[model samples]
Structures are given as C-alpha cells and as structure tokens.
Target: MSPVLLFAVSLDRAHLQLLRQRYYYATWKADGTRYMMLITREGCYLIDRKFTFRRVQLRFPRRGVQQGCFESHHLTLLDGEMIIDTVPETGEQKRRYLVYDLMMVNHQPKIKLPFHERWKLIDKEIIEPRTYDIKTNKYYRYDMEPFRVRKKDFWMLSAVGKVLNDFIPKLSHQADGLIFQGWDDPYIPHTHDGLLKWKYAHMNSVDFLFEIGEGNRQTMYLIDKGRNRKLEGAHVTFPDDQDPSNLSGKVIECSWNPKEQCWEFMRVRTDKPTPNGWHTYMKVMRSIEDNITQDIVLDEIAEIIRLPMYAERIKLETQALQHAARRR
Candidate 1:
C-alpha cells in the first residue's frame, strides 16, 4: 500500500484521543523546548519532550499524546520526523532540522496538499522561531525527489552516501545513516515508500597496547602483560618511521576490531604531537575516529597491534632475557 494510505488506516480511535489530550502545540511550550507529533496507521503520536536533534529519545509520554490526538481529532494519517532544540550550538556552522512534508493528519490523507502548504504547517505549528534563529518567515519548499517504485538502482546508493556525508559532520551527535522519502509519496508505517533509512559502515583507527615476542624472535611486538620481562619501558613503534621524541606519548588510531573491543595501532602521528595521559589519549582517539571518513582503511601491520601490546611484550621479553642472563 502507499505510505500515506498505510499511516491513515493504522490508527485506531483510542490512539488518536491520546495525542490531542497530552500534547501542547510547539508554540505553547517554553523556550528551548520542542514537541513532535507523528501520525501513522497506529494513531497520532507525540515524541518525548526530551527528544531533540542531538538525540532522538522517544518515550511513553509521546505515545500517550498520540492516543489522545487520535481520540479527539479527525486526524488520520501523518507520519514524519520531528525535532526541537534550544540554545543551539554555533561555530563553524549552526544546525537545524528541516521538515519536508506531511502524509496524514486526523485519518485524512494530506499528501494532496500543495508541497508548499505542508512545509508551511511544519514551520508554523512545530518549529519555534527563536529556537535556532531560523527565519521561518522566509520561503521554504520541498525540493527532494521521490523514491523508486521498482528495483533499486546505482543512483539510489550514491544518493544515500551523499546525504550521509553532507550532514554527518555538521551534526553535534553521531549520525549513523540517511533516511529517504518519496517527494510525492505520503507517510506510511512499516512500508517501503514513505520512508527508507540507510546506514553506512564506518572504519576508524586508535592506539592499543602492543606486546612483542622475545627469545628466538628477532622482532615481534605484542600486548603488554604484567611481568618482570627483559624489554620494559620500550616505546611503541609504527611500521612507518616517526619522530622518536614523539613516540613515548599518546595513542593513535590504527584499526577497529568489532569482536575484540579494542583499536589497533595505525601510525604514530608525527604531525599531531600528543601529551602523555590515558585520558588525553582517549579523548584524542575518540575525536580522530569521529572525524574519520569512509576513505580511511586499516591495512598496515603495525596498525593491527595496540600500544598496550608493546608494553606487555616488552615485559615478557625482559623476563625472558633476565632468565637467560641468570642461566649464563
């Protein structure tokens, strides 16, 4: 079924009543607070007051609001994303969410509304004017293309990637993927057209403990384990040459292990010198990983082992050497 049709039919009478009873229009709320009302086959619904662009945390209150709306109004089908935020951040860029269109309201299909009107309601009823310094008085129109009715194509993949790349950096929080909706399509729940979300798999690098093997092994670094070993206090090394002076401090991204729950060493960054401290290393690693794009891949050997491995390996090798020395 069409997305709009699905959303409209899903709502039962009880669900609609809850939305109208609980939710106050966005304009009615205090500054810095926002509300979202979504309509689906189940009914009209409100998102948690805590929900925002930074975090989408929907909860029970929102469900109650939805039930209230369905019971009170004729609103039928309406399904779309909502966001509210106050004291937005600023610097390189400011962030804000744009509502594109409406599919249903009060059990009535509203996609037939001119695209312009749908946008107008979102601006007027939902987003507060001063919340993000958005000039709603200006013209905003829905310009995106609709989803494909047939088989997926190459263009679809490219579009998904492009959307993710464009927004992920600007968002204050983590962005996993992009959501696609047909420009002409109406909102639908549990259906193909009204919405499709695409998530991308990302790669990152970080420093981990490395330990090196000893005895009969000329050079093998491995994870550090507590032991009175021959090689103690040895600095971790990247396969590529880096300034030794900078080597003793800081961890760098090497690779991510989904199962191991640790990051492998990549290269000691000579350019970005870091100070010594586990907290500092963690902060740097997280920031760097967050900035990493899909283009970066972990392929180097040294990057595979973490920094801790180096310390553990050194301890083991040190003990092995001490044992050999005693034998002599």
Candidate 2:
C-alpha cells in the first residue's frame, strides 16, 4: 500500500548531485513523539513514526458568541511518537518537534511546490504568525521549532561529520540519521526521488523481536512482510540502562558492524510492540550494505564543483538560487 505521506530515500551521490543539495540537519529521532499533525484540517488522522495515517474524529470546543457556528477546526491528538529529550547534564528530558518540512498550509497543500518556496511559505505563514489569545492558542495550536537550512557554508560537510560534529553536540534527541532533500524540486509523496536519508554505516540499526539463544545469548527475528518467511540472526547489543537477560521475547535494536563482520548490539527499541517486518529489515540492511559513505559524498561535491560535467542537470538551477538569495 502507498504511504500516507512523503518519505526520504537513502542517501546516494547521484541523487545529491542531481538536486545540487549539500546542506542537511540532523534527523532528530522523535520516535517518542510518534505523532503527525494535519493542520487547518477539519477531519482527523493519526500519523505514526512511519508516516502512516489513520483517520479519526476528535471533539472540539463549540463557539459561544457566533450564532449557529460549527467548529471546523480540530486538533486531532495523535498517539504516535511522543518526544522525550533527555538533558545530558541535568538528566532531565523535554519534548520538542524540530519540524523538517511544511507539508500543508491554510487549506493549501504545499507538497507540489519547490522546497525553497515551501520553506519561505512555512516561515511567513506558520512560525512568524502567533496568537496571543491564551485560551484559543491551546486548542488551535502547534508546538514546533523552526527548521533552518545552510547555503555555501555547509556545502563541504560529510555525512559522518554532519552527525558527529553538527548534530551530536547540539542536539539532545537521537541523532539517528541524516536526510538530504532537493530545494528546487517538488515533494514526491512516499518516494525517494528528491530526498535521501542515511544513518552512520556502522550504526545503521534495526529492531527485532528478541528471543533467548541456546547459551542464554539473545537472538532476534523479523516476520517477513507477507507472513511467509522468518528472517532471523545474530546476538544483539542491549541498551545502556537495561538488563539484557530481561529482554528475551522483546523488541531490541542491532547495528551492522562492517569491520567486525557481525551485527553488533545497539539498544532496546521501546516505541513499538514488535520489530519491523522482513521487508523493512531487508531495506535497512540494504541501506547499510549499499551505503554511500562520507568520503564518496564529499568527493561527489568536489567533482561537481571542479568539473561542469558532473552536475549538468541541476547546476544552473542551484546557481540561480544562490544568485537570487545574494541579490535579496
């Protein structure tokens, strides 16, 4: 089935050069906030971490002063990812939404617009406008942080350096991965056309339904998407604060270690009841195995910059954007 929203494709040099995109922010693992909001929306829908939507109706406050007024605005409270950010120094956790995109606006779907235009729309229409009415603000409101982008200053970043140097120190949330998007192209729903997402090759992780092994070593497995095959293997690493022995028959995360030639342990995935199906497991494995590394990525950029032949399709478009931005 087609996904209900836009999704990112795994990072690749060809796609990056095609889009002429170099800047990216850390992908905050807001799995705890497994929630998606459809704003200025009359109907209801619940969005999961996977960006799947389930329609639901939620009650809202009725207008008192306006005669025969019907409430069209509904703040559909989704029960998906609940963000829990832990403070490293104070050991306190806070919830936040570092919005990556603006998919919709006041009854206007911005998915078809180019990203640079869509980003400007988001800033002007959503973030800049604020309501002072405390009572009304709570209901017809949203909690989100501004999503920013860098220009030439960030063009030389590596996927590895992006996560470690840019994301790790500045963020309290899980710096799970990196996402590259096209600024000159329209949003392609449920596909990786103009978008590319990736995690650290070594830390490319996946969750599985864990079981105890013969020697008390833990193993995990995935039920294939079609319910046909069971894909199982390897002892996984337990979380920093959990008892590994207690995790038998539960969900846990495992990372692919290319150097050690094994699947190493990462953490216990607590967000969902079960591990991802076989299809997803294979998808993640493929991403890790077929990863386009930081060095190759940077090399691609350097090639495009040095030689005109490397990025002919979108080089002019990118240059135009920079030129316009400078003039403004």
Candidate 3:
C-alpha cells in the first residue's frame, strides 16, 4: 500500500474558526485549502471535492509514531498543531507534528464528547504511552486556557510584561505571543469557540547604511557603503532636527514595500518615549555569552549521552541542562 501523506494546513485564526463551524471533518491541503470529509454509509467521501474513498490510510513516518498507533487502532477525526522548534545554538529545526484531539475512534466522531473526555483520551492514547519518537519535542494534553485568552481575561495584563521578561532569559528563540486555550472546552475546530491567542507587537531594531536621494526622489534610501549603488533597504534619518549639518548620526524607521519591491521609510516613532539605556547593551552581550555557555553545556551532555553505561544519568543531566537553558 502507498503511504498516506499527512499535509498540514496553516491559517490565521479567523479563517480557522469559520471552517470548524461549517465542516464536520476537515481535510488539510498543502495549498492551504480546507475540505470537509464526510463518512457516509457506503464509504468516506470528500464533501467539497466530491471524491470518494473506500478505505482511508494514515501514516506518520517522522516523529509521527503516535499517529501510527492511532492508525493501527482505526481511529479517525484527529486535530492538532504541526509544531516545529528551532535550536538556537546550532540552528537545527525539530518537528513533532502533534495530534492532541481525537474526534473519532473506529469511524465514530467524538464531537459530542465533553472536553474532559477528549483530553483524557489524548493523554491515554498519545501522551502517556510516548508512542512517538519524541526527540526534542513533547505532546501536551492539558487544558490550554493559559495560552489562548487575552492576558486581561485572567488578570494577567500587568504581569504580562514580567512574564515576558522572565521568559526571555530562558527562551532559545524570540517569544512571539501568548496562547490561551480553555481548560474545559472540547477541542472544536477553530471557531474562536474556546481558544484565543494574544500577540504583543514588538519593534525590531537594526542598523542600516544611509544614502542621499537623487533624481526627483522624496525620501533617501539606505544603501551599503561598499556596494556604492545597491540599495541595502533600511531606515535612514537626517540630522535636520538636532544639528541639521551632521548626517552621520540620526534615527529612522525602515520598512519594506511589497508592492514596489523596495525598502521605504516609515516614520520616526515619536512615542518611543523611553530611550534605550546601557542596560540594553548589557542584555545583548549577556545573550551572546549565554548562547556560548549553552553550547558548551549541550556538548558535554551529548558526550555523556554517548556512554551506554550512563544513559539514565545522561537523561537526568540533559533535562537539567534544558531547564537551566530555559531559565537563562
């Protein structure tokens, strides 16, 4: 039998909600289209595409051993996130492609099942057995309330800054946002039904080389000094406000124009009232030092793990190192 290929669908939050309301079972496509899967008395049918199937095959080859277990049991109606993580030190990426919600078992849809039962099934079938070849990834079946709702909903608005600050030291990659999932809500298709994600917009700071505008241009373009004519695409500023004579030191916001396929200037963020301090420099230096330290620690752990005699000790040490890295 040909192996079944599982395709992941990526959608912004709003669109996901609409699909869940209208479809019973969604078929994720590589091209980002969601098709409803219908199981009739005769066979399995694709409602949107008008395709029929006598038997459906499922396979998970890479870190998908858990899904394979479900396939062995003839379970269906699965929903979950295709999660991937990037290692900060080596820049290696790892994926688990977790399946957290089981909507069907033996061709029966579990839509009417309460949230608690669905969560329990996930833990029993996927998480507890650890059937998947989970290297650097993990499967979670807990209530997702803390990550899906707005901070304000849980009186965490003020503490969000602190939480982010606390998370920064330990995180390998940049923190994007906080997700809040309801503890008691069953995993329904995206309907804003029981899940929410709050993302805090952050401004990225980068330095760019400046260039003078020529030939009926309105704004100056930042270019590389070495490559005389090539546009480097950066935010450029003039000393007009401060000294009007020196163009060497100024601040500006740079943005890319998708329509023009060129870099453009946004505006000086006047409301960026708090000037960056010496502490910011310290933080950057600390981050680099921490990265070096983590690399050394990982190298040590890898060496320890290679020794067959100390496998258990190596596992403990590796967990400790991971925890320490998160706290960094």
Between candidates 1 and 3, name the one with more favorable lDDT: 3
Total residue pair clashes for candidate 1: 83
Question: What are the lDDT figures for the candidates, one per model?
Answer: 0.32, 0.53, 0.35
Candidate 3 residues lying further than 4 Å off, grouped into runs, are 1-71, 130-175, 203-328
lDDT string for model 2 (1-328, tens) is: 4234565555544455553444332233333434455543456555665546655443322332133344443342211234456888998877543344556654556777776677565445433332222134554433332221111111222233454466556766665555565555676655455566666676667777877767786556776644524454465554477676787877777887777666666666664556766756666766676676756655655554444442453465568879999999
- Worst 10-residue lDDT window, candidate 1: 24-33
- What is the alpha-carbon lDDT of model 1 when measured against the actual structure? 0.32
User: How well does candidate 1 score on lDDT at residue 166?
Assistant: 56
TM-score attained by model 1 = 0.28
Query: Residue 169 in model 1: shift from native, Å?
Result: 0.8
Off by over 4 Å in 1: 1-78, 81-101, 105-108, 111-163, 202-328
* Model 3 TM: 0.33
Best by TM-score: 2
Each model's total of backbone clashes? 83, 11, 12
- Per-model C-alpha RMSD: 25.6, 7.2, 19.7
What is the Cα-based lDDT of residue 11 in candidate 1? Answer: 17
